[model samples]
Target: MSDCILEMRGITKEFPGVKALNNVHLRVKAGEIHALCGENGAGKSTLMKVLSGVYPHGTYTGDILYQGNVCRFKNIKQSEEAGIVIIHQELALVPQLSIAENLFLGNEQAQKGVIDWRKTKLETLELMKKVGLAEPADTLVSQIGVGKQQLVEIAKALAKKVRLLILDEPTAALNEDDSENLLNLLLELKKQGITSIMISHKLNEITKIADSITVLRDGQTIETLDVQGGELTENRIIKGMVGRELQNRYPERHAEIGEVIFEVKEWNVHHPLRPDRKVVSDANLSVRKGEIAGIAGLMGSGRTELAMSIFGKSYGKNISGTLIKDGRQLNIRHAGDAIQNGIVYVTEDRKGNGLILMDNIKGNITLSKLNKVASGLVMDERREKHEAERFRRKLNIKTPDIYQTTGNLSGGNQQKVMLSKWIFAEPDILILDEPTRGIDVGAKYEIYGIINQLAEEGKAVIIISSELPELLGMCDRIYTMCEGELTAEFSKEDASQETLMKYMTNRIKKGGEAYADTGANG
Candidate 1:
């Protein structure tokens, strides 16, 4: 127990055109929760993968020391066998399978190649009890919410006899109550003598649980800090992560708010899967030109659904909404109508819904309006390439040419491509959904600049984000939502995460006492 449980010396990993990790060093002691902190794509995940053998030994230049001895793990199974398990941010659980089945997926309770269902159920129940999850063991993973699915992942780790567990952004999607529950569970695991490594962007959560903190920047490890005994402050952790004193995470912007350019009146959208259930309830919101209005809410809070429903009725059914643009009522029947009406939605998912990964950079940029690239029917290749090239340089897509496939680019570049697609469509009102999600600090800054430029040009910008700090920073005004209802409105001067969250959470219970995340918005 006195020895270091895990150590990686001079670990390095490289991808095409990028060095994912560069000569990094990290160590975790027995029963210690060592937090790995960095912005997105800062090699925190890459270094962990190297230690866990997601990248085979021969692929990276490093030595992994486990439990006072050097270990060569060729695969994830071998690492798990050595009492190591990694729970990725994107959970690997099978949605269709029962929790018990997922827990013992590879290592099942079987004799003569037949599973012992009775024994599996009992074992799963015990594991669930350890994690304090109240769900039945036989419930399908898809039927439960994200928070419960996370517990199942932990249970799976426990089933493998894990000694050191790695959790990547475990609570990124969880609500406040769920996030607190997960953090408490980690402390409980620590009490049981289990060591853990957590990679997260939420500095608040990290400060609450981490024993020691390791900061990584651009594939290199910053000096590790011992944060026990009230030494860990948000200021210190942020300085280490960003490598500079941030006067304000949100950039300075004096609002030049004017008349509302876009407004949604009596908007109600039913659930796409279940039309009888309302996803957005008579939501009324407005964005003024040259002003950034933010929508802040937890996941499944109908923020995205509201945006999608308003953007050409692409999201929900039984949609009863009146959209007004430039002080005139506009009927948006479909996505194309939404675009033609100068309304565009940048989806939260870049790889899944936003961009054509297989297409070249130019193709993606011009995909929204090919008719403009031609006189009548045929797409003029020269004009298409020129349009792609222009936005590629304008948005700083970082590719040599517009011919590059979007899939080959980095996450930030892919996001930029997604943005470029919407910008090329020439929409007057742009709704960005999680625009800076999974992007690094540098990229986020660039994105902020782009957003400012968009607003400065007198376009209406509506930002939807789970990160409260971002809304406080980028948005001139903020709107709070909970349980599919629009609850509170805030001005930047009077807004903070605490004030905003209060309204966001308080709205959960039917018209209960109104509170703000920080305080009253002046």
Candidate 2:
């Protein structure tokens, strides 16, 4: 009998003009945690899709072996029936549905073609206990937080009698405590003899839990290292993913900050749903020409809400603020008004708010600034193509051509397209919210380089990020926020992780908030 629980050989998947995966191979031992590591668009997810029957049997060229026997899976249901279940990054749970309903969505507790409500709730409660979920089975999935939602997803998998589990970027959006809890649950699962395959960009978690790590780059398998063989390190894994030794995770840059060009003063925003609740309180900040300023905050500190409200009141109600551009005060009413005033906000929710995913790359890139390629209300095809192709090369976006669908592109490339859309709008002040979220280290370095280039061009830049290290590495100045209030400010020379955390957690500290000396600083 073979020692491996699963084996995939010679897997090759192709899309229109794109070979997403080529001759990729993977092996998973029973009751061991396997990790798949790669740069964006390097075929990690594609390979998992093949294994989970998302691509079906005839759509791809591959051989799958489960339990020492060749198996042909026709769909996700077939794979699930054989004890294989995959939990995607963007969860598949229905928000309004109860936990019991979500857990046994397709596979329900039924008798005579009618769902048995009592049996479904009972089994759901048991599954929830196993996954460390405390919510009642009758609780609505939407009423719970994201961290809890993750647990519900695991419980759903457990209900399916999943033997080999696949999780893609499981902790990408989770906070520190929630992430630790999920990792611990995985460890507990491993001890219980449930094999797992996790795809993640977080090397720390992978090193801690993964028994074996497989590295893939550009649709080809590079190497797989056994953790038990020796002590594995993130640096070693990074080399295999990028095929080079990266001395610094962030690109080096020198600051050439000039006079402030954009500023917000006495900014306040109220919760849209809760009229009396203030989400952002008396916020004041500014950004100068050639300066990269950063906002460091924990989740729900109102950083995103502030940025959106200031960018034409797209987020909150009862908005009160003063916007100054080039020392002149202006009233910006909507997104178009903000853009006309030479300001653009690149949303953190890139897929939902940033890009038209169904549109081609060329169309999405040029959508923000169509006036540049228009002649009397008609778009010029040649001009649009030329502009799109220019950004594709300048940003080094990995795509076959500009005509490819934006939705099909990887996270990194999609982010690049979003940046291109705003850059083409010729904005003087650019606000980036989690610009490097969900991308690999190599792609992050590339994005940092682009931000540096933008700064070098004398554009004012504002960055909001969850990672403290990224802010320390890229920003010339950093401001910490806590509970919808600006708590502290630190120059690059004085800022450290320790100091930032102090302010980040002290929401009620006396005299915490600090505004810029001039009316024009972000």
Best by lDDT: 2
What lDDT is reached at residue 19 by model 1?
86
Which residue pairs of candidate 2 clash?
285-522, 286-521, 286-522, 287-522
Per-residue lDDT for 1-522 in model 2, tens only?
667999999999998888999999999999999999999999999999999999999999989999888888999999999999999999999999998999999999999999999999889989999988888888999999888899999989998999999999999888777899999999999998899999999888899989999999999999999987897889999999999999998888988999989988999999999979999998888788999999998888999999999889999999997999999998999999999999999998889999999999999999987899999899999999999999999999989899999999999999999999999999999999999988898899999999999999999999999888899999998888999998777788778999888888887542533733322233
TM-score of 2: 0.97
What are the Cα lDDT values of the candidates?
Answer: 0.86, 0.91
**Poorest 10 consecutive residues of model 1 by lDDT?**
513-522
- Per residue, candidate 1 scores C-alpha lDDT tens digits across 1-522 of 546888889988898777888999998889999999876567888888888889889999989999988888899999999999999988999999999999999999999999999999999999999998778888899999989999999999999999999998898778777889999999999999999999887778888899999999878999798988666777787777778866555556666767878888889999989999998997877888898989999888899999998888888899997888888999778999999989999998898899888988888888888897987988899888888888888888776678888887767788899998998899889999999876655567778888988898888899999888888879888889988988887778878888788768766532343333424333
Regions more than 4 Å wrong, model 2 = 509-522
